[model samples]
Target chain A: MNLLKEVFMKYGYFPGCSQTGSAKEYDISLRKVIEKLGVSFDEIEDWSCCGATSAHVTNHKLSTALAMRNIMLAEQQGMENIIAPCAACYNRLIMSQFEIANHSGIRKETEELLSASFQKDVKVFNVLELFLNIGIDKIIENRKRELNDLKVACYYGCLLVRPSGLTKFDDAEQPESMEKIAEATGAKTIDWNYKVECCGAAHSIARRDIVVDLSKKILDDAKYHGANVMIVACPMCHTNLDMRQRVMKRTYPEHEDFPVLYITELIGLALGMDEKELGIDLHFIDFNYKDLVPENSGVG
Target chain B: MSVNTLKETNKLLASFVPPASFTDEEQEPLNTSVQLHRHNIADEISERTFQDVSLCYQCGKCSSGCPVRYYMDIAPNKVVRLIQLGFYEEALKSSTPWLCAGCQTCSARCPKEFDLAKFMDAVREIAIEKGIEVKEKNILKFHKAFLDQIKSHGRSYEAGLVAEYKMKTLDLLQDVDSAPGMYLKGKLAILPHNIKDRKGVKSIFKKTSGK
Candidate 1:
């Protein structure tokens, strides 16, 4: 915990909705590792939804207002940078920041709606962006253990890449940041066709069949590509792929069970934390760590 | 024109059709590419739409990544390019925007990073503005059915979405014969209701739509 305070002293955090509910493993493990690294996540006061896909669909003005509300809070809290772990939330928040900053009329209008004036004071970061910015050398220096022998596929869904100018952390068509993080953990990263394909975000709720089909394709391709585990940095993507695996198996009998993990969880496992501590127990898909991990590894 | 004398009508019609060049006694000569300007709809363009279209780079990435591109009359990329060129009426008439599933894939994969999905959405927005109804029957039925389901349940229920989708696209019900057996096996559920945030959902809809 002392180490986390040191690392997170300057970090302001935003967990978004999915991180609280479905992908809580990301929260648990992320906190665990960052705590060890002395990073503190001073959450903003009275944060609201980043207006995911719904607000954007209904009205552009409302979507900008929704994102501006949280950014205003972050700015008021005196934190210029906030880490939004979920890709969808990050995309929405950053995209809104870019829009609100560039357009004077939009900034004026949204500020009026929120009953507050706006300035371009706050910026959003996806978790990978923070990791990259903090420098991989720092993380590598802190590695207590290695995760050698795990064949991992780094899956980045829609939000991370779309509207590339806003979330300019990596290339949209071919992102290598996740793979770099995986390699830093000493895991073998696999290349696959559907790496950036949609896992059907909110479509999972309104369109289950489509989500199932999309997930089945993702899981099957990952397995066929020889990946033992799929790693995600998005909570919504993790929830749809992990929590809905049973439904997917039932819908498509050919799909075999495969574990979906948050990148933080893998980092925890590599750091020699117990499987249960990383929240791997919450996962629906069964995995045998002994076979996937090196014999000397401490994923107990 | 009588059917027996249809050849004369065909010849007359052929004369009306412009050749490589046309000469008129009173009209001025038009330049090459003038045909394109004749069909342009700049005056009918919506300024709000232009704001969205100006972001487009004519990147074919949206077309390449689109899932329903095969079924679309205009590819998603072409639709945005068309909008940028001020072919507003032609773009509105195209089936591309109406066919989008709001997947975010095109918006996700765009190299120039244009929100083709949002532009497609703006097409719907402008369509409603112009009071031009959705001409595609399947898409219309889909909107109606999903709205009916949400109107009933306050949130979209999966079973309801599926049932509505199936009803709207009659071919889906035929697949239903094989579906219920899977449903019986716990793969599907008949009743659909909001799982959580029940009242909050109604408030959300109301707040956004002014319902």
Candidate 2:
């Protein structure tokens, strides 16, 4: 009676923009880890962007319409559930669902804008929710290598459990879902303050300085709490925390290197997947897996 | 004069103080003209976002929880207060909306259940519509560049977005050192992944933009 196996046999995958570019590791590790778990994902064919923060800030209607088109596409392909790996995409999709369901004006306007019938029934899940659906026992049972040496700071960032009215999955302010999932891999999760802190998302390019400053505080907090590595689910958070470390070094001479790994990558490692196969090598900060394994573990 | 009685006397004195006169006569008069014109900013925001800005009681919870509050010219609570006070231009012209980051933390922790994040969105949209000078030009440039990428390709192209943003803001040479490393890691797609429904995407953009 493996409820996990039956729960997510298939889902519509919305990789979002970063999965193909800035966060390819998330896409790769997600696919590899899920495949090992006997789950399959059918990507929505020719899906467009979800509009993210840009459209929402500039034009609310455009944001809803953009996300609605993807939902419509998933429905057209007959998917009951969708897994948006990026937190921003998941937030936008779910926000659109909430808006369309509650506000008839928005629903009518979105339908008219896209010229498509909006059923608005498809369920959107973030990566954390996807794992929760897969069940923690399944992850613990499938672990090929214990991650005892890994001290993880589960950074939820923002958008994962926000605007509680819309997400409704976990506590918006104090999220423990990521910590629970990270601990399932035998990794010790740190109790840190900046788990739900903002990592200066979407300002990675336009305002790198702010991203650097904000990410520095998060990294500093995690390290101060004795975390050797940080685990993140959102690609934007990963970019700011991991990619911006280069600038951190230049700005603050005391800045030390810190590795940021996607939650899927952590699970992939626990499942005995290779670093290269999991795209861990693609990260900006270096991660030495040999040091984490025990001397006589006979693993890897 | 006991301390409590003195405080009450000061409060009475404060109540008698005349309103500050508009230093710049060229500036539109506050409250009086707004009342007569029936163009209340709070009502406009409420109508646009469906959020009752009147419900905000200046608790400052939104401002305190804001991650980027230090960067904002006006605090989140004060922006809502400014709207409540009918100072729409001040709220619109401030850099608060541009620096919000759309995290929804304020809206989440707000005791009044005010959707401050969506309110910020409405402020930014209205600011642009009214042709107000953007306090944070680079942020707007970045957003425009991002939207342009989506409009052309129906998806966000990081390479195209970066190039367009750099050209637009002329903040060239910023993050140049990291570009090579990102490209090497296969994180920067050289070509845009154009979707099949380009017409559909374009139409969505056109109709929403009111073009």
Best by TM-score: 2
The residue-by-residue lDDT of candidate 1 on A36-72, one tens digit each, is 6546688766555666665565356656776677788
Q: Which 10 successive residues of model 1 chain A have the least lDDT summed?
A: A202-211
Q: lDDT per residue, candidate 2, B1-211, as tens digits?
A: 2334434443554355333442234456534333312345566677788767777889998899888999989999999887766567788889999999998899888887889999999999988877777989999999999999999999999999989999998888887999899999888989999999899899998998965
Best by DockQ: 2
Worst 10 residues of 2 chain B by lDDT: B30-39
Query: How does chain B of model 1 score on TM-score?
Result: 0.60
lDDT of 1 by residue, B92-159 (tens): 76766665656677776666555667667667665544545455655555554544444355433446
TM-score of each: 0.71, 0.92
When candidate 1 is compared with the true two-chain complex, its DockQ is 0.12
Count of clashes, each model: 14, 0
Regions of model 2 farther than 4 Å from truth: A1-8, A293-300, B1-24, B28-38
Among incorrect, acceptable, medium and high, the docking class of model 1 is incorrect
Q: Candidate 2 - CAPRI tier?
A: medium
